[model samples]
Target: MKFGDMELYILSDGTLTEDGGGIFEYYPKNIWASYEVDGMTPYRTDEHNNILAAANCLLIRHPEGNVLVETGVHDKTLNYVKYHNIVKNPSLMESMKSAGFKPSDIDIVINSHLNPDHVGWNTVIEDGRLKPTFENAKYVIQKKEFRKAMDPGFELKNDYFSAEEDVLPLEGSGTLELVEGEKEIFPGISVIPTPGHTSGHQSVMIRAERTMLYAADMAALVMHQEKPRCKMAFDALGREECWRTKKKLLYDRAAENSWYTYFYHETSFSVGIIHKITNTRGEMEGRVEKVEIL
Candidate 1:
């Protein structure tokens, strides 16, 4: 969908389905279990635990060039067996084509964080050579994020990897821009530092008269936004800060009344607005409504 002159699209490199328990290991078992109802729970779960589904990436286009918010799964190396039924075979090229964009046409690629799911399509295997997918675009990532990923002792293998293959190659080719906190990468696009998920994790905020926040992992789902105290099991800095950041974003946006928020794992392929309504007991409830695809 198009937002003003900005064209937004979903590029599905692929989907990853995880167990619900694995997602919220940081939260108490009782607290997590309270959310389950009927036979089906709102959170994705395997036989033993609950999980969150990593949806596709958001592709944004402006008159100057194209900006891809996140890159989805790169290839079949990562497990796809569990999600085979729910996630259709991913063809990012086809998805881009459907949205009226080509790989070569993308001019800017932004890595919200260095997570495997977020940077999966950063490099594509072509004739056995791992190369940048967006040939002409400069890859923008946080300086601290790149540094943390580059650290050899980083324990999480799946989360951080060799900069040689994933990140440094782009820098070597002079196609990387490592920006500091709250830096403007484009005229209307800015990166806001939102740590806790990762040391350098950042959220993308697009500004106009009305603003849109493409909050990457800050609030993975509606439930996370609703219950800010809830935490993701995979969070690096524990749950408290994550919850604090989530609450701040949710409350701040609701107070503003004009900000459109989008989550990476949101079910719909559109922008959502949060509304507050008073309950029968005079308690405020937040409702998010999808406003537009862009």
Candidate 2:
């Protein structure tokens, strides 16, 4: 997907098959199952009602430099992959290699948040020790998110389980750069705080004449972007705040500006433009529709 002078590539860390209950949480299965985007169901389900979602990351070939957004679940030795029955695919490194780039090619790595799945590739295990994966790239993240991940009380410990191994090592390598609130990492690429999934969750915006918003987990699925209320079980931390963040970014900004958007876990399709439309109930709704750029 070319954004004006820049090119955007969607690379998968892998696909995860999880129970619907874990994906939807409070959102009833029947209600979400009935909803479709552009006459196509957004998720693939099995007999056991497990949803297959893609852990997608974006690589931007920019004039300034190569930028990577959201590294996928990088830990295979972890018990969660076995406990949750996660189906691993080609890792972020392999995907990047297939895309004709290597670790040194990445100048910056923007982490939306420090969840295990999102920051897994920040470090790699070598010589029986954890070290920065992208040795030459500067790992950019929000300061608030770093502090929270470093000391996420007992209640939130599970979410940041890999932080000690994946993220903390970046600081030691002097590759970690923490910014507060909104800041532009490059001339046209910026990170905007879209807190809800986590206190410091953020989304990346690639701006040209039109903007492309990397919704990350803010809208993990196409359905989540279409209906902000239908949240994931992982959204337990700030469920209410998540909805508000969706409204602000998905509806108020993306839809209003018709920005091209990317959903991190949307397996079928990840990049598209958001459109606002009125439903039969006379309520305004956001629809993510794919558009061709001329």
Candidate 3:
């Protein structure tokens, strides 16, 4: 999809089937089951009622530089029980090749956070040693995020399991660039803190003719974008902060500016414009509407 002079490609690592109850946390199964966007459910459940979601990465082709956001889960990470049902189509590498580029073509790799699924492709095992997958690119991430992932407290340690192998290895390779707050890696591409899932979680923004917000896991699916209060069990670290950020970005910023929003785990209609709507109770809500790119 081309927006102005920039071409954006969604490269999916694969699908992850999660326990519906686990991802939705305390949200009642009956209520969440009724949720839909544009007549399509971004998630699906098998007979056992598990939520199957997609792991999508974004590739930006800009004159200034080529940016790859969210590396997607690596095959090695699939050994974990949670990822046992993961399905990879055109893996990140294959998808990048299909996009007319190689790992060397990537200028920067942006990680929204250091979660296992989001940073799995940061490194690849070569000669039985882990190495940065995109050898020529700088793996840009939040300094605070790196610190937390490296030394997480007991309660959140599970979330950083792959950091030791997939994330920390970048440091030794001299390919990691940790920044504070908001920083623009390219002229129009910047990362802003949107902490909820993790204290250091950040999101990508593409400022073109129409701004684009890669909400990442902050709005993992359209359900969260359409209803800002909807949160996942993964956000236990900063649930309230996450809700506020969602309200501010998806509602105040994206909807107000008509920006094209992208949710990482949304299997259907992952990219759209969030329009503000008044529901039956006269409350302001967001509606994820379809978008077209030139």
Candidate 4:
């Protein structure tokens, strides 16, 4: 994945499982069953069946230093994300080691959002307190998202985020850098606002010889764009906004078949270009045909 001055690597943080009901409305029951987390659950229970997803963190290497995107889940936050499975023997440290770097070597961490699964590795529980996991990294977050997450909400819809375990630790470390809207993190790396999954959720864009969009929760799963519409069960926060964002990304990058997009929660194949496939009705359709790089 070498393009221009940037070399991008997709490292595995492990996997997760969420209820099938997390998808949006309008689909048929049998069709929805396919959304279940496992092959054995193709006929899975809608209310109980879980959808297995992966925690894929991206690592961008440059002449200056390394930039990590998303940091698997932490053990302390397991109660919030019970379905999450850190299958990796020792979690992110092992993944980072395989990539030729250590947690302490990361100079920056760009959080796609503060969901427990996404920011779990941001801190570690040490002696009854949370501490920064990446001792040398400064985290980048959207001001808008941070405010909303900080504001009150029922656990109701907000238990997925833990400010104490994830945010406050960084705050105490004085390494949290809040930015407005979308901005470029460095020469070739940029974070673009693609709200909906979370009011402040943003995706990452890397521009080198080719363009790639890390469609965070905005399009969490690759199958999300496989269907005619982009909908999710947990889209309660920004329903309307989520639809629009998904549409634009699908039409522009996925449909147009330009950018090499990455789905934050996909397991089968994460990186690929979407193409239009013909259906039995002789109509054109969108599907994510998997392909690998590096």
Leading candidate by TM-score: 3
- Candidate 1 residue spans exceeding 4 A from truth: 26-44, 48-52, 76-88, 152-154, 161-164, 268-270, 276-286, 292-294
lDDT accuracy of residue 114 in candidate 2: 96
Local accuracy of candidate 3 as per-residue lDDT tens digits, 1-294 = 987788899887887777777677777887677677678665556777888788889999889888899998745754673554777786888888887989889889999999888887899889999899999999999999999999998988988888889888898788999999999888888999988888899999889888988988887878777765677887846667887888877778887777889877877766898778878888877788876543
Spell out the clash pairs found in candidate 1. 19-50, 19-51, 20-50, 20-51, 21-50
Error of 4 at 291 (Å): 1.8
What are the models' TM-scores? Answer: 0.84, 0.93, 0.95, 0.86
User: lDDT by residue for model 1 over 188-285, one digit each (tens)?
Assistant: 88888888788888888877666788767766765555454555767777667875666666555642474777777654433677665555777555
- Relative to the unseen true structure, what is the Cα RMSD of model 3? 1.6
Point out where model 3 deviates above 4 Å.
Answer: 81-84, 292-294
Quote model 3's TM-score: 0.95
TM-score quality measure for candidate 1: 0.84
Q: How far off is residue 21 in model 1, in Å? A: 1.5
Task: Please tell me which model should have the higher lDDT, number 1 or number 4.
Answer: 4
lDDT of model number 1: 0.68
- Backbone atom clashes (below 3 Å) for every candidate: 5, 0, 0, 7
TM-score of 4: 0.86
Question: Residue-wise lDDT of candidate 4 within 1-294, one digit each (tens)?
Answer: 776788777788776677666753456656766554223333244345665667778888977779999987655745544555446554677878887899878988999878677887888878988788888988999987677667637742364457666777787578888988879888878888888778788888878777777888776765566565656767545566776787776655656765677766777666877666767888555666566676
